[model samples]
Target chain A: MGIGSDMYRQQILDHYKNPRNYGELEDADIEHVGENPMCGDTIKMFVRLDDDEETIEYVSFVGDGCAISQASASMLSNELQGRSLEAVRGMDRDDIIDMLGVELSPMRIKCAVLAEKVAQDGIKIHDGELDVEETTTE
Target chain B: MSQQAETLDVERIREEFPILEREFDGTQLVYLDNAATTQTPEPVVETITDYYRNYNANVHRGIHQLSQEASIAYEEAHDRVAEFIGADGREEVIFTKNTTESMNLVAYAWGLNELGPGDEVVLTEMEHHASLVTWQQIAKRTGAECKYIPITDEGRLDMEAAKELVTDDTEMVSVVHVSNTLGTINPVSELADIAHDHDAYITVDAAQSVPNRPVDVTEIDADFLAFSGHKMAGPTGIGVLYGKQHILEEMEPYLYGGDMILKVTFEDSKWNELPWKYEAGTPIICQGIALAAACDYLDDIGMERIERHEAELAAYAYERLTEEDDVEVYGPPADDRGGLVAFNLEGVHAHDLSSILNDSAVAIRAGDHCTQPLHDVLGTAASARASFYIYNTKDEIDRLVEAVHDARQLFA
Candidate 1:
């Protein structure tokens, strides 16, 4: 289990075992759901904005998926607090991978990035740049 | 040891597959992902290389010597596959790209013309995306209704529900011979009888069955049967669709241009013979010949013995995997299923389990196995599948169980 241990780091497992900010937020200012169609991993992100509306006051997520996906969502939710909506949207694949603290393969990369995509797509929908439909990370 | 294992020279059979001898890091490869595709043995591989080396030419066209040899070998491949599947003659066998193409061929050429708004097409809940999606799109185009035979709690098709579903309005009944995810061996012959009683055409998607067991199209009295070579120790890009001669004669061509024509004028064109009429353009020449070699190889080992070997493996896998707590194995009892096991460990997603198993050099499938609807019915996002073939062994299954235990530990 040498290589497998490396892929599922202690930090990632902690996040997966005890996910932070995990659940639906009541009357969220922003809400979006996305799914990895290939593996059926889903993440629905919810955000409550600050008075400025550009800043994220609270964020939560609810879904079922592999360890990488669930852990990434938990880590991403922890990172969301006190961050600007723009900053959250600016969060890229590298930021999520850095948060997870593990190297992912091509297929695992999708699981790692699903949370980031859900957050970004939610912001886009809130801004009316994209329609409010269920997004998919095919 | 299982009685089937005693009859089969598994040690000798394993030697034919060099890939099985491969080592990942310090661990050996324990490949159990046979449902997706089987690894080709040396003989089939040699057949492929031999074709290109000696007589690599376009089939059924040129007057040259190379074309004659290539054409004869290609036609013989058809005869071999027809005999393997118990088709009447080579005329009943038509080679296409793969099983999906075969399903599309029947859907477009038969369903589109025969179905109308009131017409119904019956299928099972356990169909792979190949047949399910193909028929769904066809139903949309033809304004026909699509009905699915519900599965019982044990993951077998609900035959009681089926009799209620297939009425006079039903025009077609397409079903998978084996469930790719559940590993349930559907009673397609019984389904065929029901379809026939209702005067509906039945097509069997034998992609999972033909590679692992003896499938007789004549005994089933099927209108059409589809299977892929890649899943049967043959090369990719080749598949067979066996249709009764009279039915194939009545249907229009699915593809056009090139060799599938009698003659063509500026105004119109007449079609070619039975199988050729459906396969337009240049067919998979070497792949077809290599597929025949695969059939010959399976025959030499005996398909009944192969079927028995897989069933024994599946039962063993089911029992071993079930011994672990929170490990839910899907499908029927060991004796009732095909050569695979679909399962999940609690709190450990299939991808994670698959990745952990890879650390031990164990390869298994982790996804919906192309049966999204079936997964939905099972109330799972996805599942992990360990499929067996002729070459797999009980020792490899033990390795899989050990890796799964390792995955459970890591997740826990």
Candidate 2:
């Protein structure tokens, strides 16, 4: 990799190339789709809750987007396993940026955090706090 | 190289734009985003500074010396744009915020009133959202049906489809003169003939065409034309809309306020004359003046020379990019395109490509380029665009190619 191009570190490229948990959960109790209208990066997140209905049993996503966005989804999916819905909902922009380990511009921040948004919105939709046709990370 | 390209002194032209000398670290800035906006030259910047320093007054407002100077220069800017586009002086030119507003001015003032339930508005699949959305909303409001002219496999406007679509029911035919995403130089003049044959008025979105080449509204028989100033080396927040005098006079004003009013009562008002009637409140006086300087700068170099320079650069970039492995360049063959090239690198997203290229100080645009439907047609979510201008060189494109090569390897 070229110097000064740390944004595409090997870790990010690895996750982007072989995304972990990169598929849909057919039995997902909570599913939501989000899109970054700026770059047309879309992520549809699927989360299945355990019998307690609080802990995430499994999480996966399927969509087309840039490396930052898709890798973000992959990394976030791995992190979301066994986490409670409350924990996923509590996740914010800083957590995603911290996980990426890169200084993201405001535009890239939207791409980096799109998966988190979809997961949170899916929880919100399940709880009946928000109503919308589709969630978007504007 | 073509004769016109040979006549252009690119080195001398590069001197006018000090921004070209900018460096990211030790690497010199290779600006390939001219399709988004061009770098402002010293002349246009000086004009803007001079207006603010010496004649910072509202035009057509005060009788003072500064106001008079501002008014005259601002009015002359309209005439300059008129001459630039081969239109009649001042009478047909109206300054709006940008090309989007200029298009809305037409869609609202003409389309809203002229179009009805059965009327059709024929646009192309390659239209920028500025034209497509404005007309789409207008069609929704007016109950007019919007039809699209499809594109050919070569990424050019299907003239046959356009001819078939623009029937007697078509009231307005608006298309971009150059596809900003594909760099396809559409056959607008022929499309104008078709629109006219069916008694439909045609509008040309010259946002891409006006900056890169010699575009004559008269030669194309365009009833209306729109272009932004910033895309041509002027300041932002200023754009030009040129319409036929008769049509402009017959239509009601799109906006209404102080400057656009000749007389106003509590319940009634008489709108101002042709151009002023459309310019509502206090206008972009300084920007309008500076845009004239941009026109002057382009004229001094001769637009034909600039066009040839960009054409050659685009063709070269296309050739070089196609030489790269798994690089899919969009648009027609280089001979039939404008100054831009949009492409995709296999297994690399456009945004990722843009970021990687940025590390090498090679700037390019990455996104849908405001042509989402067009991207759908291209079957890609987004593409990277490298656009050229008068100051860009083959050497810069070489740097871009080398950077892309590095990016591909890095991704691999």
* Fnat of all models, as shown: 0.70, 0.57
Clashing pairs for predicted structure model 1, backbone only = none
Per-residue error (Å), model 2, residue B20? 1.1
**What would the per-residue lDDT of candidate 1 be over residues A1-138, giving only the tens digit for each residue?**
445667888898888999999889888999989998778889999999989999999999998889889999999998989899778777788898788778787778999999999899889888999988658473
Cα error, candidate 2, residue B92 (Å): 0.4
> Per-residue CA lDDT of candidate 2, range B1-412, in tens?
6765557898898999999998887888999999899999999999999999899998999999999999999999998989999998798999999999999999999998998999999999999999999999999999999999999989998888888899999999999999999999988899999999999999999999999899999999999999999999989999999999999999999987889999999999998987999999999999999999999999998898888889899999999999987999999997778999999999889999999999999999999999999999999989999999989999999999999998899889
Off by over 4 Å in 2: A1-4, A132-138, B1-6
Candidate 2 CAPRI classification by DockQ: medium
RMSD of each: 1.8, 1.8
The DockQ value obtained for model 1 is 0.67
Error of 2 at A17 (Å): 0.8
State each candidate's chain A TM-score.
Answer: 0.94, 0.93
What are the Cα lDDT values of the candidates? 0.92, 0.91
